[model samples]
Target: MRALDLTLVLTNMPTTTTLRLSFSPSPPRPLSNRACPHGPVISQLDFFAFLNRHGSFLTPLSCCSLEVDRRRRSPITMLSYDSTSNVLANQFQVRELNDETDFETILSADGRFSVCGFGSLLSERSARSTFPDLVNFRFARLNGFRRVFAHVTPVFLERGIARPETKEISGLSVEPCEGESLTVTVFEIEKSEIPAYFEREIEYRFLAVLPQTLDGKPFDNPAVLCACYSDEEFLRVRCKGSKEMFFQLYGQYNIDKIWQDDILPCRAYLRHCVLAAKKLGDEVYDNFLDHTFLGDRKTTIRQHLATKGSGIMEEEPPESLKIRYGG
Candidate 1:
């Protein structure tokens, strides 16, 4: 996987068009399928149209440019990395690419990191196969999303797996679902089951499962990467021995937004938890308004009466979760 510094990335890039950022704390604008008056909205159909013409989704770095084009008509860059990973897997090495390149940066440099790695079968399956097993062995714990800030932008949910596999290693499969924004509950401290100051510890949890799936069972070895920021520093934390190690300084941003804001920090912490869980290969626990459970490759659990068999779902009551969580 390739990573870059945000400061150098922003400074080295040349600005082209004027960009405007709007943050509305009010209820989110209802999603519409219609075209926007300002410009045509890019949808899955538009994304696939570009794929049909180009043979592959736009490169991650290239997405930044497409996003900045104010008068894009039938513009051809992809926004999401879902399809891009497999399409570019052997063809591309992220580490070899320069920091200034990416699809999202080209779209809107001002785009806030709303979770990207959600809502797909292929991406979820890749995450399932590549991540590690959580100590609790739950499926909901297996997945999560991250906040990515990109100046450039492209189509969301880009295409990747034009094909599917036929294997069942553990009879597990992550089903497809719609997107939802939720808070993070899990925390990866310097050590697990040990107490520490909240500042020294990292808090996070999963966001949503992209509508993608894998054929084989979840993989035993999954690598997770974490980006952490406090008022003092920003760093990447790599998972190792049940705990993630922090390294590779990613530079810093004014926490003024983070500290002055309430929901942003909470959301960031939740995103961190999910990102770590994805690396760890643990199933994420989805907290629907009324219930929660451990999801596996094949099943969604509702009761303790029946076990999902992946050992991913726990047959525990909701009260148990409340007690363990103290919420």
Candidate 2:
């Protein structure tokens, strides 16, 4: 059999009479050495690099340094060996490391840290060329949608980071679906240090994968409800409750105005949604519209492009009266 080499630092000198050795079948055996008394000794297992003809294998023992204070000497020792192998599959194993070694690697993956990191990256100017082409969409509006409008709120709508970040947005992201639908996961990278009443700001990140393409191109006039304020009509979402509800309510409210011909200012609405979504956590939820837009976004955009008056004013003719100077 192959021997594994291991060394231990002795605080209390171990004469041959006091020395002892133990072995566990799981790790094979450590090479024994009593040949040297003045220096470090090598074990037989350390001599050969064991080759794996097929399955996976673990190093015979745990490698760690042993500290000796008496003689001011520190030596290395092996503790345990663990491995996993499958006859027809690849082998895998998880080695348990010391607490100090493992924690340093995992700290960055914690929830709060992720939120803050994303928030920092988002605060900078966003690039706009990444989105798809649209007939009437302005680059500026697209930029707003990507960075501010569609983004999540810093405060989690569900209270904690355990729930997806998407819960905080307009509140329309997550819901039960029967047919083709979307699943969105949202996370807040950072909650702003400032209190809500003071500035009410947050930064967030969100992601959604949908089975069907939103295909905004097909809708006669698709519009993003964008944002809203603290009002009962907008789903009664308090800072403590579901922010997703707020987004849903805001969308419905906008649609109400569209049907009533009391069209709200699109830019203002978008800006509000952007800021509101940020404050809720850092991330917010949104999805493709299921129903028709109460108002036709395409029609509105066309009107803006034409820049012409409609109805009676369009039909009216200019008067023949001419201005006279110095008559």
Candidate 3:
């Protein structure tokens, strides 16, 4: 009776540690399971270990559990509030979560807006910690977009997610894709608070998007949020002229490095993001697995989780940045 989030994820578990990719704009290192000279290169083993530990894989939590429990299959995805009515009942439909996109509507009301969240902000705990007064904290989906962990950030380092000893660090971002959607959180903040949010999300592009409710209906208005994509030209457009001014206001540096750099997701932050998705319920968790990807744009979080889910989530963030910066 749980709704399958975004039904997507295609990954092949690599047997070795060294990355052998055949793509031009590849990540600077291995997608994951990077071969460290000091350690054994074991990836798939971690996945099986997770299965063994959990006994029967639970729905939404396990990797690709939508097709699980062949003996007890059921119809009807979940019980969420109706997009239009904000009421829940048997007629509550999963179909509404996957709405068809109308580009014209999205473009019409992008400017005067509030904020949306796809990454850490998806966590109400993290959201409230950052924006104490955020209101209308609700779920929405941004169509024609997919979330990925492609861009680099020092925040990971400061959070101790990225230690100096590990493979370089990367964070999450959203990019344009056809026939794709992600469950994101949207909230309203005072106009006076925009500067603080901008600074917190310095290395990102403020994307204007039309967000929809669980039942395939658009919000009365559009929203703008830092999508953390790596398109400089697009950043210029979204920056409202002079990306430099935008950066200065946000107190960000290394603009070129943030985009052009290659790094992998820190286990700690990756675990945090995946756990955040998990908190949104089974559907949102599955949606995250299906859409979220490593920097390569080829590796799925499901693929990674399937093999090393236990270790990654259990692994501790490095003391590199925390010790250096005192976070």
Candidate 4:
């Protein structure tokens, strides 16, 4: 599969005019409804009609299937069907293409570094706080690694301190898994932000990775990978949490008092990661849920909710855990 950066162009036109969009480094091919094999062929008139009706609700950089070189690939593009001339005008004003050329300059320029984030950093809100001048971000996959909860953190260790009898909990890490691939968000930010990012990730160590987009396009620049708790470290530190604790906290769907106190922050972080995945859309989100692990197993939010019920019905975080984690 090939990656294409697309641009939408609208010429002086009337309300009934056809919408036209262009792709850089490639020309537009005949648009087809590849989504449905036996469905009616989508004509320009049908496309325009649908756009005029639902255009306002559509996100500017939404993903859509396009036939390219005899294969279907999803390219980042803006397409709108507007009933009014100003609708197109308004949409274009709000969204502009951040082209690959600009991205390359930002990547090659000084005071910039590429980091692969697989956790809370995947969230736009979290990443934006650190890198206000974030150049770009995209979905990428790291092969030969699997995410796990193998690193003992200060917060969990603090919990252990408070209740010396309670088993210690650990945070997330990536371990080598031959033939496995871990989905990550590869983004570029100013070098000035590196120190703060590292501070937040005190347990992780940086490793170099040649990042590849989901479509197998290798990034030109090497990405900084933050990893923790290799097999050796896992064995030496015995960072694994009590299997009993894992089942009690995450195995069921309900939020027990212990879960609210000890597991809520981590669950909150996981929610952020899920939100980021959702922003990428369903296919990407499904892939993320499939590959990611909570403690020891891959579980979906639906499964969690079915088991635990909603937060509204759950009890508050226990005072002890709140004070311990400084929540």
Cα distance off (Å), candidate 4, residue 162: 13
Best to worst by lDDT, what's the order?
3, 4, 1, 2
lDDT of 2 by residue, 274-319 (tens): 3333433422222112210112222232242233212311221123
lDDT (tens digit, per residue) of candidate 3 on 1-327: 343345333233232123222222322221111111112233333432432342222223322332323221122222223335433332211111111131122332322235778877778777777788777789998765677676667766545556445554677777655456789898876655655655566556554555678887766655764554434433454355676765654337343445432456767777777778888899999998899876666778899777744477665445643222211
Whole-model lDDT per candidate: 0.23, 0.22, 0.54, 0.47
The stretch of ten residues in a row with the least summed lDDT in candidate 3 is 91-100
| Candidate 3 deviant stretches above 4 angstroms | 1-113, 228-256, 260-262, 308-310, 316-327
TM-score of each: 0.19, 0.19, 0.56, 0.46
* Candidate 2 lDDT: 0.22
If both were scored by lDDT, which would come out higher, candidate 3 or candidate 4?
A: 3
lDDT of 1 by residue, 1-327 (tens): 233222222222243223333322233222221111112245444444544343234443443322232222223332232342322231321110012122222122233111222221113332233232212222222222222221110111011111112111111111112232222222111222112222222321111121112332322222121211222221222122221122211112111221111111111112223334344343333332112222211122223114322222222213422222111
Could you give the candidate ranking by TM-score, starting with the highest? 3, 4, 2, 1
lDDT of 3: 0.54
Query: Model 4: number of clashes?
Result: 7
lDDT of 1: 0.23
Query: Residue 226: error of model 2 in Å?
Result: 5.6
Pairs clashing within candidate 3? 3-77, 47-307, 96-215, 96-216
